[model samples]
Target chain A: MYKGIAASRGIGIGSICRIIEHDLTFEARQITDTAAEKQRFREAVEAFVQETTAMAADIRKRIGPKEAEILEGHIVMIMDPSMSGEMEKMIDAGQCAETALTAVCDMFYGMFSSMNDDMMRQRASDIADVKVSVLKKLLGIEDVDISKVAPGTVLVCRDLTPSMTSQIVGGNVAGIITEIGGKTSHSAILARALEIPAVLSVPGIVDAVKDKDTAVIDGTEGEVYINPEGDILARFVLKREEFIRKQAELNSFIGKETLTADGQKVELFCNIGTPKDARKALECDGEGIGLFRSEFLFMDNTRLPSEDEQYEAYREAAQIMGGKTVIIRTLDIGGDKDIPYLKMQKEDNPFLGYRAVRYCLGNPDIYKTQLKAILRASAHGHVKIMIPLVTTVDEVRGVKSLVEELKKELDAEGKAYDKNIQVGCMIETASASLIADLLAKEADFFSIGTNDLTQYTMSVDRGNPNVAYLYSAFQPAVLRSIKNIIECANKAHIPVGMCGEAAADPLMIPLLMAFGLDEYSVNPVLVLTARCIISKWTRAEACELSDRILAMDTEAEIVAALKIAAKE
Target chain B: MVSKKMTIKNEQGMHMRPASLLSQKATAFTCSVKINYSGNSYDCKSIMFLMAACIKCGSDIELVCDGPDEEKALNDISEFIESGMGD
Candidate 1:
């Protein structure tokens, strides 16, 4: 067996199977000409329609109306002009029921494929479902397991559907090779989830391999070697075993505080999106939520959420944290995030234009509504509200005024809230970093949002694919900004935290720790690594390393020196 | 024929996840279930139609069922929609 990039983890040993390119073409559809066939077709169509209706009803019962809007595409296909017209045309052409449905599905899929919006891409699946359903009826075949083929099966197809991908469970017969699919494809997702090794979009994959040839799959690296020699197989097997052991070792440390050779303590926190993520954070032994993106509340909605509703959501998260700190970033929407109901005008350059506290300043009504919710929720447990992308000190003062306004309203109504609640600002952009000392005086705390900080410092647009690689937290300017902000915060004796991906990287942990970061909030997965790094160094050693880094002219030398100086 | 009535409840009323669940469950049955609100009636499996009706958390609607498990389907479907999606 040969070694390749493992797109996913886990081992699968199986004989190679014949590769087949999946043709999505739907033919031999039955539109039904004869009276008997028409009758059957009508019954099937009606059943399909009713089935779709009941499903929508169930969805309405769970996620709510705003989210259920996605289902309208499928509903439109089944009921109105989309599917109905296709079926009628096929019937008029005197085609069979399956043939007619297939023709209609082709037309619908074509219409959706041309649309610009990505959310509409799933509309193609609707037509595919209709074609698949009609074909299933005609062939008299029950559901086929797309996740795993029959025993001794090493099936290779062009691409897998979402439903089929979800069906894939661990311990499959063997390796999978496909010609079509990308990093985000359904087959790729399944491979990642099942931890089965598979290679995707491997051009000329079919010609090189054949049935009954033993193959090795490395889904993690997206590598598949056909008919490998003994030496190669032995090497891969050893590597796979080592990876599995390391993974298990990481899991065993979950919920345990990390401490390295030395004993200097540093708080390790996790970044979160929803209350559900709180569970994962707890599992990773996070001290508390370091950066909670709270903008999800307003993302896909026609109306603003009520204070009580927001309170319950915040309370749920607080209860999950079990009284651990939860720093909730308030109204981070601006720039890329736009809510129509909030009446945010479109800008030519959204990133450099209005966003964060800028939008909140203009729309204090909406800002106060969220403030009320956060203040009300504070009664449940430790909850801190953080404002995003703050530059000038005036913005922080303005934020305080609004908080006071809400506090007065809550006070008159006799509503209970944490009286001395803390307020913080995300030091993300260059302007914010430069004035961290001044802003630190106004705000209770500061958290470094390195995702934006790095982009801004390097003069690269993070969203632009070509420039994205240039945006690195390891850059000297980025580290300088972090150093400047930390130094400023230290001058005021206020705690400073880093909550971006850089804060979570084990390789970068020593860098931030060297900058005298009091707290590190990262993806829950990185908290252990950060804690381990922090515990090993003395405050004095870190300061020297930090000074060396600040004086460096180039980023490369600083990184190399950091590696040598940091405790292993 | 079987019929039942209830108010829509789950907080994010008639949204994506709930609609998919309703549609998936509906596909399992051979019967027809239609929900009526105001003067309009929509197929229960049509997530869009249900969502188009814009039934809020407190809105009342009638669940009408006809077919193989009319009574049983009516009871189960009614309880599901009325009990606010899932407990």
Candidate 2:
């Protein structure tokens, strides 16, 4: 059994289909006519650009603009004069076109790889992608299109690039097993978006599993069984049927209102990063967008987005939601999310340093621009602003004052906007949870960012592998913090919602129901599953179970109690 | 000859987008345009040269143009930089 991170939930049984990456090696030979070599390079680049542009258009129509933008980035790289100019200079010095391209691309790749910034370093992979595409064009190599693969085949690869994943159309692939990538990797995200079974970070998986070997992948369990015995294969076949049946059953809950057995209504929403994702959220029958991450708008661009640009994006999402509440979070950058334009200083401990609301508070111009955009978008649909990483009531007040000021500015300028746009605070930090009542009074609503709340309450860095085991939302301390936040919001008569990974967890859903959570905002794919889980339990029984589970001290004991409660 | 000093306001500095834009603009002129940053100068028509200069955000650089259209080239390039290269 090969253990890995279960990136997307599903069961896949199929014959292994290895993804053979073409070796990107070329023979270096000096060319006599430098101008001819330069022309050859230019032609290849132009062709590659044209090809990628067409691919981008197809991807835009099929997947969405965000995924299509990856291909657009490739076109930019091809058109980049720095790369082509360097190649021209090298060719002028009597080097072959392939050799010149390789040397120049490798230099940039090395520079990107050595960078301290994670996002910048990831650009190295993108450079490699460009190199491969151009090199393939030059060498007349054909790409192995995944869409051409037989249905029910498990794809085994070292890593999948955006280009490769884009070719996986028409449900041709059954499962994906990669040697590298965590839960947040590109492949994992794409797999989840495509609703494909995927197991990632399985070391030596490509080497261990041969082509055409029967493999059973349990994405939920994070296990891959290669060449299983007769009995095991038979058991997995039965399990696969059951999994399919369960998924069909969950689909039935999609258009239905999310309610407990006793008829207590709970809003099930989706958390989206981009405006394009609102379509997926709607398809999953989300009540609304609980957490619309606004940082992606800043991160994907080369410069600060104009107010018009931000307004257009927000308006599109609002129009799609069609009066459904779209809770958009303000620029939550800093710490892990570094924007080159912002020029934020590096900190020893970024998580606790100047980030999120702190950064917004300091840069009033940037913050106000986003606020104005959100306010303008509110005129189109149900839009609410949610401030992230608030630890003090002062921050909430400061944001409120800014929103009021922006609203007045819009009104004075005769620009149309929603007069009564709601504002909320994300109860993520321990301090925020402790003073939730105070925040509740100032804000229209409260959404528990359980991922951060768990990290803060447990005093564990969730990203650090050394202490990742301790970063559990079910921890007694974390659970207590969640309970306190919910109770405080309840006392203040403000609706409390959860917009974190924990909200999607089946084990935590009943406990949250017990706490009287008004909403559950999770990934779009989990909307139906979460609704299904909520429909199975009565709020009264969940409240009773919460009391029993809260009395437990250890994680194992709490888990044991949950198992018994689940059977009920 | 015409020359102007401008700071790179774009967050990503002289990355591929701005470098391409600047080079394309320079190629349209009849003048020899060069960018000087941190005591080093590079031809503005070469995208690789501009990007390789590694001019980051907030870094001030000088654009010098010589021959016909030098004044127009200098003004247009400066304007492009000031506009954050359309970001």
Q: Which candidate is the best by DockQ?
A: 2
How does residue A509 of candidate 1 score in lDDT? 73
Model 1 Cα lDDT, one tens digit per residue, B29-82: 679888888888877765544544455554677888889988888877876775
Clashing pairs in 2: A82-B47, A82-B48, A341-B11
Q: lDDT of candidate 1 vs native?
A: 0.70
lDDT of 2 by residue, A139-244 (tens): 8888887888999889999988777887887478889999877786667777877878899989988888789999889888899999999998898889888888
Docking class for model 1 is incorrect
Question: Which sections of candidate 2 miss by over 4 Å?
Answer: A1-11, A19-27, A30-54, A84-94, A133-147, A157-169, A177-210, A216-225, A230-265, A268-516, A521-529, A537-562, B1-87
Assess each model's interface with DockQ, reporting 2 decimals per model: 0.08, 0.26
**lDDT (Cα, 0-100) at A139 in candidate 1:** 45
Best by lDDT: 2
User: What would the per-residue lDDT of candidate 1 be over residues A1-568, giving only the tens digit for each residue?
Assistant: 3343345555555676564433434466443345666666677766655655664454455433432343444555455433555565566677776666676677657765565533334445545755665455444445555445555455555555443443444455456677666665445555665556677777766777777777777666666777788987787788778767766666665666655335656778899987668887986789999888877667644567667656766877888898899998988886778877878778998888889889888888888888888898888889888999888999999998888888899999999888888998999989999889889999999999998899778989878898887788878888888889988888899889989988866557766666768788988767666665566666666666677777888767877887777564
